[model samples]
Target: MSFEILFLVIYFVAMAGIGVWAMKRGKQDAEGFLLGGRSLGPGVTALRLQSSSMSGYMFIGAGSMGYTQGYFSMWYALGDLGGGILNLSVLGRRMRKLSQILGSITSIEYLEHRYPSKWIRLIAAPVALFCMFFYVLAQFIAGGRGLEMVSGVSFPVALAIAIGVIVLYTFLGGYLAVAYTDFVQAIIMVVGMVWILVATLMAVGGFTKGNEAVGEINPNLLTMWGADLGYQGQWGVILGALLVFSIGYMGWPHVVVSHMAMKKPSVARTAGVYSLIFNLLFIPGPYLVGMFALILLPNLANPETAIFEVADAVLPTFAVGIVMAAIMAAIMSTADALLLQAGTIASQDIYARFINRKMNDAQMVWVSRITVLALAIIGYAIAAFDPPAVAAVVIFSTTVLGSAFVPSYICAVWWKKANAVGAISSMIAGTLVSVLWQVSGAPDATGIDPMVTGILASTAAMIIGSLASQKSHPVPEHIGRALDETAKIGPIPKKMLIDQDALLASQAEMAGRHE
Candidate 1:
């Protein structure tokens, strides 16, 4: 068999094996299926978070941007770092506590509790569905693209295979499967990226020659920061792009679900540290790889295809197949996570909470699986449109999530005075305003990013209206209890690790409550 086909078969078997293992645990019920019974360890959480966070965009979109933009792309990496710091320091602990308090199996569940409005939950369900649906589609498209690019196969056949693998693993194991697969995929992604990065250094003849070649192409590309050769770029534009992309980190359904899946909320502290370090290495990958391409493959027509160009240039055929599988790993890791989260939220928060409260765990799990299949199909259909541009789709999805949910999520953890009236109002206003801002051709609109405007406006509405309508919600007792629980951050020993018996006991309590 061809190396590409061989690699594909190996990857499929590995993913399926993970799914089978995870399904054993998933048989427990909704919590098992969605949050892995809140038993994910620090390493698993860190790997899953990083893999899901670095999506198709990082490999294809960010790579393409770096090819043209050079060191300016590093701003995106820095911005993501900044966002991670914010998530861990400001929102991370609180989110863990809150999810436990509200019995929130998903992010939208937390949203419904904070707002206490069925209407807000209703609005959020479809929005989450839409964003994740497109997000999954983008991943499938990238997966198919990777297959075609590596194997020289037709796009349709490649797409079908990509979608098939993702659905098989995801439908079988749910979040449990996604988490373990994410661990493996994260390692593969890092290795593949580092391999290409090393080859890029060699291809460009070293850092100094790389800089010289970039300068030869366009002096601006060699600088630490600047706009595009044409007027399409700016320092502000780059900063805005990076900020919008990364600030939404905590709000994306997949990423936030990682937070919810933590076995111990304190594990987040350790996971946060590891994630920060790993992201630093991975985020700069595209920028460096793309810059190398500028030096070696300047005439390459499609900048997004530059990573593959470099891979084919340096690696042997089998190695190229491995790299292709690794890229698909990145794509599937994110797609499965998002698909599971969306399906979970749809069944539990939307269908169970609003549409069908009497639905049993078995029924909910079935619905969640169906939702996953439906979303995968939708994403595949969208990817069939074959958008060559990566930045646009990525930016649009992040912008919507960031604008709509980020502010409310922040308030839920921080602002005690925040109420349902404020939460519901802000989500609608922020999402609508952001959508309108984009519709108004605001991506090119001067200095401010659309998110900046939408977030600011929605925040004002939430704060002012919350203050004005003090009687709208009495803060849940669980919120206070969870906060009190978190306030007692126990002293860390010289060697710290979770006590499994105590962890299992706590999980049993959560399960009992669910029952």
Candidate 2:
């Protein structure tokens, strides 16, 4: 085998080995399988969150944007960089505290507990699954294309191999495996990205020369408004580009589950700091490399392949293998997370909650695994035959998911009166508005993006829906108490905000106090 192929084999073997080890550690309990028993440390949590959040979108989609749109793509990167910090700071600590207090293993379960509604899971679960499927589909595309390039295999064979590896690791180890593997992948992603950036810069004689070359080809490519000045004076599109990734990820169910998997509530503070550091190192590299590729490989037919093509073009034989692994790392890290979350919802929220209420922990674990396998098959089929634009799929799904859930998720911990009606209404309205806005091409006509309009409609729906129904559907007393304790961060005696390490006495004390 060539060094590239050999290196890829070694990388795949290592990932599967980690899955086996993690399986032994995590065991088969529902909590262990689904949430890693909430034992992730700050560093692990931070990198895992970032790795899963960036996904193939950063590797393929972001590069494509930069290759085509030039410096304008930087707006999305800025939003993405800020989004990580914002997610950790805004939802991190409180979400960790509240989800545990409510005994939620899944993000959807947390919504049901906080809002106190069966309908919440019934409706929310499907919406989440639908949105996440699109996200995972993007991964499948990126992975297949990456594998096809590296292995020189047909697309079908490459896609199956890629999917198989992701599913195996996720199937064996569950959340613990995914988290640790994500940490490893996050390091690889940044290193590979920086490697390509350095090589590209050297080839082009540095950033200044690269820009000058791009300018000579077309001065518009050097402009922040995008090639041909496509977005000039379109401040609405500009704001949307910045806001979409920055605030949008806060609403992603797959991403926020990292908050629930944290070892403790206080970990969020350190995780936020870690995120800031990682973002600065990694976020801008892909876009910068993509723009540089415009000068180097101007005739590149597939813009999404800019980074991969750059690595292949610039790196030596062994180093090329390393970059290929990094691209796979980007794809697999997020693919596993999406698979796990979708499976968790399918099994815990729908199968157990609705189909078989009395199932035990072991049964739940099996159901989750089975659900994951089923999803992989369906996702593979869709990806193989009718692939949509990876970037478009990611943006559309994330926009809708963020719009649908951001208001409800933020309100869950922060607002006392955020009733089920409000959450449900917000989810429905946000999804509809975002979809309609995208489908109807209202964003094109109005010069505003779907994210801005969808979030606005959803936020309004939440406030109006909750206030109008306060008398009819007040926040349950139990959840209200949990929210209060979650909010009351200071003055708690012992191991900080209602610690998990403490004995059952504290829990009972709160129960008695409530009664």
lDDT values of the candidates?
0.72, 0.80
The TM-scores, one per candidate, come to 0.84, 0.86
Best by lDDT: 2
Tens digit of per-residue lDDT, candidate 1, span 1-515: 57777887877677667666666554456665565525667777687668766788888887887887787777667877887777655355456555555566567776776567787788888887877776777777777777777767877788888898778757654433544556777778888888888878887887788878888878887665643543344555555666675676566864453333444556555777788878777788877887778777879877877898888888777777778777877887777778777878788878897778899999888998899888777666666656546666777777778877888888886777777778877877878887788779875666556777677777888887788888746666666554554344345353453222222323544565457
**lDDT tens digits, residue span 1-515, model 2:** 67888998887777667666766665467765555524667777677667766789888998898899988999888888878667545355567667767876677877888898899999899998888888888998898888887777887888888888778757654433544466777778777888888999999999899999988888887778989897999888888788788778777875554333434555555566677888898888899888888888999988988988988888888888988888877787788778877877887899988999998889888887887788789888887866677788998888998899889888998999999999999999999999999999898798898999999999999999999999999998988878887785445454343233222323644785668
Pairs that collide, model 2? none
**Residue 494 in candidate 2 has what lDDT?**
43
> Which residue ranges in model 2 land beyond 4 Å of their true spot?
14-49, 90-97, 172-181, 254-268, 485-515
Model 1: lDDT of residue 326: 78
lDDT of 1: 0.72
* Model 1 ranges with Cα > 4 A deviation: 14-45, 173-181, 224-239, 254-268, 386-388, 471-515
